[model samples]
Target: MKSKNYDYYLIILTSLILLAIGLVCIYGIIYYNFLAVKPEWSSLYAEYIEIMNSYLYPFLVLLLISLGLCIPKRLLGQDILIKSSALILGATLVLTVIFNLEAGLGFILAVMIGIQSMVLIMTFRKSRAVRFEKHGYVVRLGSSLLHLGLVVLIFNFVTLRESPSHILIFWTGTLLITAGTIFALYPDRITRLWYTEQ
Candidate 1:
């Protein structure tokens, strides 16, 4: 029988792309609003923000589409719960775009959190070895932390539009990225030593 599993490399590549896009979006928003404070750069800042806003949602939608393609259909399963969750998440994202309502965005964020949590739970339950294996753990940990950073970012978006929130988002994202890099590059011996009890 043909394997039902998707290529792990493909999943990891796509996820890394998604993470980069998300970080770029966050950085653009932060830079335009806070760092581009010079009087002369006002027009440039406005132009940049305008261009980014115009393309951001469409890019996100495309990312979701690509992610769906990358994920194995069998893994998702044909179930009422999965269908309902997908429908609700899609509707919430559409509402967020149309109304730009905080509640709608919050709902979308909540749905994302729920979905990521479920994914992580299932992954851990099925693949304890993957979670601990040096290379395998990098993929698992990087993806999980990336999802968590994205969720926190969505919260940062919905909450007060202040420096504190921006700082929080930046630091949280940076931390996730930094940790993922370390996990990916460090020697297996170090990872094993760190994770294993003496």
Candidate 2:
């Protein structure tokens, strides 16, 4: 019996579920605050809800890009997917750097961009590997890039906060520990073994 080609189905189902969850989270956050106040004095609620909705925009973009990554069955080759994903990741990284000037909002946006880029890159690599029937160096580089991006994200969150010196010290330690784990696990354990010769 032949195995089923369910990759596209899986991707679509997963993306839809994720999108729904994100939308629900945004709605709940806005509605929870909306319900806690009286209508007469809650005119600012509209602005608050809009601001909350803005946060879900990145997640929506991510969901769409993930769907785009599932195009191998429709396309003739994997090259298109890999190149397009890399281009998207590069463009998003540039935008992330440009938006790095602010604190909480900027940090969240930057991290979201980084995470989306990682997902795109990984999907691209996975498709390319399936086409070529061999593992390559791109996956290793993608893993490293993801780990570095996560460390930067953590640092961005820490430095954005206005806290006492003691808290800063604690955050510094936390960042170090997290970065160390990424370094040890990403190249040596997690992604490295995934691409090892079978």
Give the best candidate by lDDT: 1
Return the lDDT, model 2, position 114.
53
- What are the TM-scores, per candidate, against the unseen true structure? 0.55, 0.36
lDDT for every model?
A: 0.56, 0.49
Which candidate leads the pack in TM-score?
Answer: 1
Q: What does candidate 1's lDDT look like per residue over 1-198, in tens digits?
A: 122333455467668777868877887878777647867785687678666755565455444434433332313543543465577657867787787645555565565556565555655465542222224654565555555555656556544457556886768767765765565566475458767965
Which pairs clash inside model 2?
Answer: none
Give the runs in model 1 whose Cα sits over 4 Å from its true position.
1-44, 64-85, 101-106, 117-138, 154-160, 184-190, 195-197
Q: How many pairs collide in each candidate, listed in order?
A: 0, 0
lDDT of 2 by residue, 12-51 (tens): 6756868786776978777766665866547666766565
Candidate 2's C-alpha runs over 4 A off are: 1-13, 16-41, 71-73, 96-198
lDDT of 2 at 20: 80
